[model samples]
Target: MNGVSLQGLRVFLAVVESGSVSGAGRALGISQPAVSGHLHSLEKRFGVALLDRDRPIAPTRAGEKLAGHARRVLAATRELEEEMVRQRAPGGTLAVGASTTPAETIVPGAVARLAAECPEVSPRVRVGDTEDTLAALLRREVEVALVGQEPEDARLEARFVEEDRLTAVVRTGDGKLPEVTVEELSRASFVLRERGSATRRAVERTLRAAGVEPKIAAEIGSNAAVAGAVAAGAGVGVLPERALPRSPGVEPLRVKGLGFTRPLVLVTERGRRLSPAASAFIEVCLNRDGR
Candidate 1:
């Protein structure tokens, strides 16, 4: 009917399901008088006696027909709302934060896959160190993050995406760099990533475990910067293996006793529901085939 409200239909369904006016009030969190008022209003609007108020309430033939229609209407309304949410997810902008290594090596492929799957979703990416990326997540500046290390915050969830190792890089003319030992690394001046970088942390931890403190010559911000510094003979730089560009002036050398590896993690705020675009991008990052 023109005057019929969804609220009246909801109360009708509650009464039908609960089998009593008092039970409907309890289920709908309203008073018994309010429930009765709603039912009276609904019956007046439809010009039909909907319920037979006996010892236990029962719907009349007209009430049964209206109840069936109410169920279908509610279901269709729910489906419409869900479809709207799905449409907004793929058409809206998705913000993502990424640590330096993954920002350079991993995020591009995932973004490409997302573009192929959902062209309408415009992904905005912010690149920073591990700590900065986590901060961005906490501030809700980004919906998801690809970080080099697992976040320790209780409010964050991390999933392992892949593993990456740090390689010792030196200048191409640096005496035909071969496999070197940890002892040799200790003596060399290292152009390492800045303090908050996951790659720098892994490199320093490995060096400390070997009882050799690396001589820090230059502390750079990004992996690309570290590679550039090494090529210019600033010092030996430690960077993710995949981050080492195939430039003529730089060469990657393996350390014999040192293995610097870190987990590449996909991080999201715990208990936060991700949009469909963000979820799809995560699937691309985790699955090798981008499925």
Candidate 2:
């Protein structure tokens, strides 16, 4: 074709960063075919392989050379975009709404990157359950949202960022327990997230699927609260592994048949163009400088 495309560079970089075509599609909010099309165009334009299409994907020697240049160009373009954004709207606070998992884990790092990218923009995060965060987005109270659950509304779009696994944790000094079947796990009391939490929904779905109607010891709001309650001997808390307490008082466990995972997604209003700050934050969240 003509010269190389910025979209091709982004797709190649995404594939390189995520190590899979599907992953690049997810990160870019595009279809797999779209990602492959961009990659094909890039390879056609360069007339050389940019990626080694094998397990644990990596760049070819030529690709390594291209990637260095691509990063510089993409980064330069990003800077120019931000500068233009500043000319349009110089400064404002970015209201970020997040569910418990991402608020505690992912948003902080993304905010750090955004701050470094655009110091003039301030970021403020409001933490809530998944439903709450989505509601905030619907209401336009927040420019963007990070949530563990996918939004179902037609007026909103969600992009996959990562997955979070729910793990069963117990107090450290409470002593170990033998393996338990789903039936036995059903009998045990759980320190569960509050009703609206995506973690609670996935955990319940898995438990119910296994013929276990979860018995709750307590309903806690945040991951840390549940962990704290469990560490205090309240009950077994099911939380995202990322939220598992690294402290000496708490430890995770393996149940014989209980396991669940949920997607972490970035959500925004559909059909509406994102603000510059919101766009910058999402880019940082999905494709950080260093993989």
- Top lDDT hit: 1
- Candidate 1, residue 154: Cα displacement in angstroms equals 1.6
Q: List the residue pairs that clash in candidate 2.
A: none
TM-score of candidate 2 to 2 decimals: 0.68
Report the Cα lDDT for candidate 1. 0.87
State each model's CA lDDT, in order.
0.87, 0.85
Best by TM-score, which number? 1
Task: Give a tens-digit lDDT track for model 1, residues 1-291.
Answer: 558788889999999988999999999899999999989999998899999888588899999999999999989989999998778766678899999889988898888888988888889999999999899999999999999898889999998999998777888878474688778777999999989888888888888999988889999998777888888999988777776664457788878877888999999999999988888878889984733
lDDT tens readout by residue for model 2, 1-291: 588889889989999999999999999999999998998888888899889999878899999999899999999999999898666752578889999889888988888887787887799899999999999999999989999888889899999998888787778855466565666566688999999999999998888888888779899898878888888998877878877644346887778866889999999998878777788788888986565
Clashing pairs in 1: none
